[model samples]
Target chain A: MAILELKDIHKSFQDNVVLDGINLSVNKGDIVGIVGPSGTGKSTLLRSINLLERPEQGEIRFEDITLNLPLKGKERKSVTALRKRIGMVFQKFYLFEHKTALQNVMEGLITVQKKPKKETEQIALDALEKVGLKAWKNHYPKHMSGGQQPRVAIARTLAMKPDIILLDEPTSALDPELVTEVLTTIKAIAEQGYTMLLVSHEMDFVSKISNRVLFLDGGKIIEDGTPEEVFRHPKSDRAKEFFDKMNKLKEPEFFI
Target chain B: MDTKFSDYFSVKLMWSRIPYLVKKIPITLELAGLAFLVSIVIGLLIAVIRYKKVKILSPIATAFLSLMRGTPMLIQLYVAYYGIPAILRIFNSWGANIDVNVIPKMVYAFFALGLYQAAFTSETFRAALESVDKGEIEAATAMGMTYGQVLRRIIVPEALENALPGICNSVIGLVKGTSLASTCGIIEITYQNQILAGRDYRYLEGYVALAIIYWIITIILEKIFKLVEKKFRIPEQPKTVEEV
Candidate 1:
């Protein structure tokens, strides 16, 4: 089933357009990998799905809710409801520096959902265990490794039990040595059939895990298909050029 | 100016007045404590108003801050205490039913001092709130928090932690500023010192005692803030986020 559908999404920053009339849909348990060069609105496209960057023109239909066109100003009630069902992992990790890893994951549950503390504590712990960070649950984000922090971030989202998660350059912020560990945790989550929209530079991992890969450039999706089809036989010249540059890009030097 | 330095500088006399000034310390503390609490309440409201840039109210909050920063505290106290009553009398002349005569002198002093504190602290709060990483806020919202939840669970806590040192400064400034209330007949520690000095003709000695007391209070406060600031410190490096 199409859990979330976006139609005619357009966004711009001043004269630089970011997303231009994006139309896409995510089905339940689908792992959609989005790949593009820097500054091509890959992150912006993902953010717009969560309404983090309000598109100038778009229609987002998630389950039964629909948000039409430009988001007036601040977030609306419907947007908040939509966001609850869609979590995001940022490139910067953006963990609350003051909160311990456990507290960080537990915060959204207690504050947003108002779940009882005792129950949420156990749930947060289970989420931490899933990311293999239950041992460091009491450690603050500032005290943890880059790989560990993103796993905790993933655990935070996992605890929220959102329908779909938007991972914006999830491993980009990690040191090369830590990338595989973070990716491993992500892979473990993907195995459980969590619907995810991933924006990533690690094409090998992207091509391996994603059932479908989207090639975006100049604020538009140039190609979208199963990894075998898109990576091996891209039709559009833009997607071909994008792949050419991506092929030439320096490989991430993971010291694993 | 002609008096000998030795004649006025008696450590014994200064020491004797400390006990006399000590009794009135509570009054000074109460005024500062109450005013500081009220100021934070007002300042948070004003800071959030200005931060969010609420339509007409943003300019109003800005104007209020400008007015407070522009005027001297002494002048503000005079207006609150002396000028308000005079304005009320003018209202009576215009056949208006208003009475500022019933208001207490301490109320005016408190009103002025609390407002003064707010003006200063509002900048601290606004800056702290702005200084929080924008990405953290987006992360909070993405996790399903509404604006109100994001504020209480995310923004306000971060702002307060960041604003701790500034809050300490504002608190100390307000405590020292309560000395101005002596002019309004509030009989706080400074007013008590004046009365004590009058009894023995020891102006310099009594003032010295007041200074020592204030110094000690400030030291105690600074120590407490140092402890809190230490606790509030974002860890420097036990383990780095970059190193696996």
Candidate 2:
């Protein structure tokens, strides 16, 4: 059975249609990469899956629960439960500005799971250790670099022990040298067998890490296949053009 | 021509009022303090009501804030002191025998100041609440936190840090505004100054003394507010958002 499945998902903002008849399915332990040009609703699709953005029309199923619109009541409860099964990371690390690194990690455990302080502290510390931020446990996000803050954010989600993880351009905001460190941590996490959905512009990382690659253009999937199949030989003219353009472009050392 | 300088800066007049007026300062502070505390409670309740958009009551709260903000504070003081008593007297005449005087002038002052500032305080709190990032709230909610727990644990504390500077300024304004309560015979600093001036015929000195006292109080308050702001400031950090 699929861990997550979406069928005919449709959403539009004002007059601009962002997602039209979007369909996707991911099995457990799969790592899927979504790549697209700017303004192609990549972030919107991820947010819709989490029910942060309600779709105008669609069937979205995660495990046993299905949502046609944003879920509420028992359905919302299950949605939250499903979210616990899914960890999410963003390009701009959103750490609680007021909390220390350890406290930020512990927040979900103590507040959400109603865990005792001592136990939550232990769990949070372990997660921080996993992210190599154990020494900075007492430090607030303000005192850390962008890369360090995102690592803490990752630790925060990992503390929740989710079954699947989502990375929304996770390293897009980092400096070039810093991007490798974050991706290396993610690579390690993937090696540990966590399922992932990644939206990224890092074609190389997508080619390396993805079990399947999805190319989105103008809010619909243009191509979906293995990296070797899509990167080596392009069936679509748009894919060919995009790949050629990426190759021809002179990206700064820090940006790519 | 300048021989009547004693009339303007009479030590005798100012010294005589010192003991009596000093006693009255406490009364002013008491009234202002009580009113400020009450206003905070009323303001927080109204803010929470409006923030939640609680159906029928939310609009009522908004309208109440509008009325309080629209009218002059003095008019509100008069309605509390005079209009309320007159309505009570009408009830007394019908053999209800309600002694409206049982409610003192200080109570009227407290009500007038509290309700008025509550309107502005609610706005301050609303702005403070908005300063809290939406992600914090979402994170708490995903963790299975109830709305109340999220507010009490995460939202209110963060909002307090943001709102503190404005609230401190408002408290200083409240202290100055307490002078209006003298019109209703609350015997505050302004009232004592008036009484002292009437006896010694040195009105300027008495008013000057009151002005100095108020200035001192506010300067001290501003220092305290700065200290509090420095201590409680939300540290500037790169704002990060987690995806889950």
Candidate 3:
């Protein structure tokens, strides 16, 4: 059974259509990777699922509730409540500059979840341990390297224990060496069978971690299949063209 | 103007008399401190109103900022201390029995100075709030934080750290502005010195003592604010120590 579904999702900014009627469904523990060229509305489609970018028209069913968009006060409250169970990791780390890694992870639990201070601290420490940031939990974001900072950011999201995680190019901004640490952490999370919808340009890492890969083109999903099927035998002309172009671009050493 | 200290220009007498003027420093401090606290609250309110651009209240806040900043503070003080009573008297004769002069002169000076400081500090607040990275706010929202939660957790804390230096400058300005309270008969440092100069005719001595007191206060305030700014400063980039 599908744990999350977006039916006929449509979005546009002004007269420019950013997303056409797009449909997708993810069963529990499914790691769905979205890969596409820039300006293809892949991020818009992922963001629309969480209602961060409201769809012009669509019904998104997550677990039980159908999200109401064009979000008003009551709808907004429900969205926020829903968001508590749906975590998002940004391309930029977005770790609070004022907070330490441990404090950053604990902030949501204390403020949103209303968890006890002692319990939140223990959980935050455990999350940091999982991300290999246990020793640096007390360090602030600016003081940490770009790669280490996203680990803290992931630790922060992971501590919330959300049912699904959305990652928008989690390592696109990192240095070459730094990307390995974050990709490793992401792969580890996938191994634990957590639900994730990842939008990334790292084709190799996406293929390695995602059970199913989706190719989005011109605001629509052009192809969807297992990673081996989509990458090795893309049927759609748009997908073939995208893969050919992406292949010509030099890849980092980690891709192999 | 004729010099009042020609006959009583004894340096020893001047040194001895300086202590008397120093006695009124507490009153000057009280006036500045209370007015500064009040100004900060009003300033934050004005900034939030203007920044949020509330339909009905934003324009009013803009007009208010202009009006406070446009007029001379001395004129504003005079209006609060003198004009308000006269207006109240007119209202009293029309059947209301409220006493116009019941409020103290110090209160009027505090009101005038605080309102003036708010005008300046609100601009500082707006600029600081706008400087916080927009990406941080979006990330906070995506984490399921309510708008109010995002503001309290992310926006205000960051903005306040950025606003400190300017706000401290305003606080120091307010301390200096407390000198004007003498005009309202508050008998603060400046007023007390003027009274001493009249009696002993050592006008230059009284004036010198008053200047030193203000100079000391400014130095002390600067040091205190410096410590505060450092406490809230963002920690510099993390230095890595290689782990074996």
Candidate 4:
């Protein structure tokens, strides 16, 4: 069964239609890559999945539960419960500047889970250890490199024990050399069976990590297939054009 | 004018009143300190109300802040010292019979200063609150902090850092403003000096003394505020994830 589903999702800002009649599904433990040219509602669609930016109209079902519709009283509690299980990582590393790297990771455990301070600290430390940031536990985000911060950000969400992680252009802000560290961390997490919905521009990384790749154009999915099928043979004209542009752009060394 | 100046220059006359005026410095400091505390509490509440924009309460807060800021501080002191007492007295005569003297001159000064300062302080707080990045707030909310927890844990600490310099300036402004309370019979440093000048005719010496006091207070407060600003500076750290 699909772990997450967006049915007939529609979104717009003012008169400009950003996403119209878009639908998607991600099965459990699947690494799904959403790729599109810039300004194709890629970011908008990602934000909508988390309900960060509310959809104008649609049904989002995460783990078999419908979202986006107004929840009343008891239903609100259930929606909040589901939210705690979904984690989001932003392109800019959105780490709390005021909090130390460990503290940022521990925050979800402490605040959302209401885990004991000592246990939360241990869990946070464990997550940071996985990201190789256990030594920088007390260091603030401003002091860290972009790649380090993004790793810490991922650690933060992971500390919450979320089943699904939504990554919004995770490596877009990193230095070329630093991108591997973050991408490697993400790849490790994907190998560990964490369902991830990634919006990224790295064609090589997209081809490697994604169990399924969805090609979006003009706010709609123009193509969807396994990485080999989509990258080697495009079914849609838009998908073909996108791959042509990707081929012209040089790949980073890690891809080789 | 020369004769008037000499009269003001009477060293003996001014020197005699120095101890009496000096004695009142504590009273002035106490009034300012109390008013500062009161203003912070009042300002915080007004800020919260205005920040939330709670129905009728927000409009009332809006009007109160507008009237407090729009009018002169001196006028506010008069209304607090005289107008409020007279109104209370009139109400007492109509059967309430409340003892107006229970509320001292210092109390009136506090109410005037705190209420007046709160208007400006709340605006400062509001602005400081706005300065916090919206993303941090969302992150905090996502972390499961309730609105109150976010305000206390995330919003307030950051806002205080942003609001500190403004608050420090206001405190100094409040200290200077305490001089207006002398008009209401609080007998603080400014009032005592003014009285000494009137009786001894050493206007220049008394006025000069007050100027020195204000100067000292400003210098001291400014240093304190600068230290506070330094302490709150955002920590800059080196990033992780060694170059791949």
Candidate 5:
């Protein structure tokens, strides 16, 4: 059964339409990897699900609740309620600079969830431990490595225990040397059977981890299928061209 | 024409006046302390109003900021000291039960100094509030934090930390500003020094002693602020090689 359904989602920045009548359904425990060229609205689509970038028009049916887009004042409460169930991780990590890693993870739990302080601490610590950062819980983001910061960000989002997690180019901002550790942490999270929608430029990593692949171009999904089908047997010319370009970039001569 | 330097400088008198001048320090501090408290509250309010561009209140705050910034501090002190009682007397005439005569001069001093300092500190606070990374706010919002929660947890703590240096400067400025309270006969350190000088006619010595006292206070405040900044310093990532 579909746990989340987005119907006829349309978003525009004045004259430039970013998401053009896009429709998608995400089932429980599905790992959907979205790949597209920059500025193709992959991030916007992910953001729209949580109402971070409110779409001009859409109907979001998540579990039993339905939220019509361009939310009215009365519907705003539901939007906040909806956001609680859909967690987002940004490319830049966005860890609270004033907080320690444990505090960062504990913040939403304490403030939003209103969990007891003692219980929240244990939950936050466990989340940190899951990301392999239990010992570094007291460290602030700046004191930690770029790789470690995103792992803390992951812990922050995980502590909320959202129904679906959205990762938007989670390793894009990291240095090349730091990318592997964050990816490894994310891969570990995926193995725990969390439902996730990931927009990534890491083609090999996405293909390895995601059961489903989506190819977006010009604010529309050009191809959506099993990872093997999209990667090895793309039906659309755009997908084929995109994958070919991606494959060519992997060649050692391309770097030189 | 053979006037010795001793004619103008009275080191002994200046030393003797220190204890009397020091006794008046509390009054100066009280004025400054009350004014500082008022500034923090009003300054934060004005900053929030202006920063959020609150519909009706924002323009009023802007006008207030302009009035505070454009006018001289002396003019504002006169307005607070004289103009307030004038306005209050009108309220008194209409049976408001306010005793304009009984109101303390220090209250007026606090009002003037606080509003003036608040104007500058509001700008400082607004800039500090703006300096908070937008991404962190978004992260908090994405995690289901309400706007108020985002502000209290993420925005304010960071803004306060960033505004520390600016606030310290304002405090020093306000301490110096208390000297103006003598215009209303509030008998603070400067007024007490003037009284001592009036008796001895050692105006230069008295003024020099007052300057020394203020200089020492400024130095002490600077040291305190430095310690505070160190205590609250957020560890920053080392700048990248390219940035360096």
Candidate 6:
């Protein structure tokens, strides 16, 4: 079942068209990995779904809500309602610097959801436990490792119980050695059956976690299929070349 | 015709004046404290107005910032002391009920000093507000926090942390600026020192005593701010993965 549908989404920054007439449908529990070269509008596509980029033209249908792009004042309430359902995790983690991990997770529940303090704390604690950071809940982002911080960020999103989680290059900002912890945390979340749209450069990790794969190139999804079909048998020359280059980078190199 | 340094600056006179000067310390602190409270309130207001680029108020805030920053603190004090009455008189002329005489010199001092400090502090606050990462704001927004909620919860707390050192600096400046309140006939420590000096022509002793008092106050304030900074300091992130 298509849980979220985006129809003819178009976004441009001045003369530069970042997303040109893109269309997509995401099913329930589908971990869709959006892989593309840098500046290929992969992040823009994900951001537009939450009305962050304000697509110049599009219509989004999720659950009973239909949000037309360039949202008018009356439709603004629906954007908030829409966002509550579609949570996003950023590349930079973006944890509130002044808050502890527990507080960061509790903030949305207290402020947006208007949940009671006692219940919010319990929910936040449980979310932190899921990310395997229950012990570090009192620690601030700066005190935690780069890998640990993103886990807190994921916990923050997970506590919100959004219908779909958008992970935009969630591990791209971390040091190579620190990437595994975040990826492992994400893989654990996927196993629990949360629908997620992930934009990532970690081709191997994406393939491992995602059931569906989307190959975006030049502001459009050129290929969308099952991981096995898209990863092994890319139809377009661009996807084939991109995969080839990505695969080449993965192999260890030595200089004598 | 060789006058000794003792004649110019009598240690005995300075010692004798200490008790009298100390009596006025509370008044000086009161002026600075009240002015600081006013500055913080107005400064944050102006900063938000400017930061948000509030349509009607933003330009006015910019003009006010320019006027305050461009002019001298003494002139602002003079303006508040003198101009307030002039304006009030005009209001009275138009049949408005106002008693300008009831307003105190200290109130004018507070008004002028607060307005002056607010100009500088607003910049401090605005810069701090801007320093909050856009990504964090987006994260809050993505979690469905409204604009007001984002500002209150995420932007404000983080900005306040960043603005603390700057605010401390402004406060020290404001404390020093309170000395100018004497110009408007507000009897603070400086004015008390001047009165003590006028009695015996011991200007050097009085000036030296005032300097020592202000220096000690500045040192105490610095120590207090250091403790506060330590208490609220966010731990520094490890620079490299090796450190992590």
Choose the strongest candidate by TM-score.
Answer: 5
lDDT of 3 by residue, A126-168 (tens): 9999999888876788888889988898988999998899999
> Clashing pairs in model 4?
A143-B237, A143-B238, A144-B239, A145-B239, B92-B97
Highest DockQ, which number?
Answer: 1
lDDT (10s digit) by residue, model 4, range A4-83:
88888888889878888898888998898989899889888887776677777888898756766543466555555666
Worst 10 residues of 2 chain B by lDDT: B235-244
What is candidate 5's local distance difference test score?
A: 0.92
Clashing pairs in 1: none
Candidate 3 DockQ, CA atoms = 0.53
- Sort candidate 4 into its docking category: acceptable
Return the candidate ranking by lDDT, descending: 5, 6, 1, 3, 2, 4
Give model 1's docking category.
medium
Task: Sort the candidates on TM-score, descending order.
Answer: 5, 3, 1, 6, 4, 2
Query: Where is model 4 chain A poorest over a 10-residue stretch in terms of lDDT?
Result: A69-78
What C-alpha lDDT, on a 0 to 100 scale, does residue A249 get in candidate 4?
Answer: 66
**Per-model chain A TM:** 0.94, 0.93, 0.95, 0.93, 0.97, 0.97
Q: Given candidate 1, what's the lDDT at residue B48?
A: 98
DockQ of each: 0.54, 0.29, 0.53, 0.34, 0.41, 0.41
Error of 3 at A207 (Å): 1.2
- lDDT at A242, model 1: 73
**Candidate 2, which CAPRI tier?**
acceptable
Error of 4 at A115 (Å): 2.1
Give lDDT tens digits, candidate 2, residues A1-256.
5889999988899999999889999888888888878889898888777766778888889887787664455676666666666677866767777888989999878877778999999999899989898888878878888789889988998898877788889999888999998998888788787888899999999899888888888999888888887776868998899898998776665755
Over the stretch B23-63, how does candidate 6's per-residue lDDT look in tens digits?
99999999989989989999999999999999999999999
Per-residue CA lDDT of candidate 3, range B1-244, in tens?
Answer: 6766545566666677678877888898899988998889999999999988889999999999999999988889988988878888888899889876677888899999999999999999999999888878877887789889999999999999999999989988998898888889899988998898888678887777777788889999999989999999965656453351
lDDT by candidate, in order shown: 0.89, 0.84, 0.88, 0.83, 0.92, 0.91
Per-residue lDDT of A247 in model 2:
82
Task: Judging by TM-score, tell me the better candidate of 5 and 6.
Answer: 5
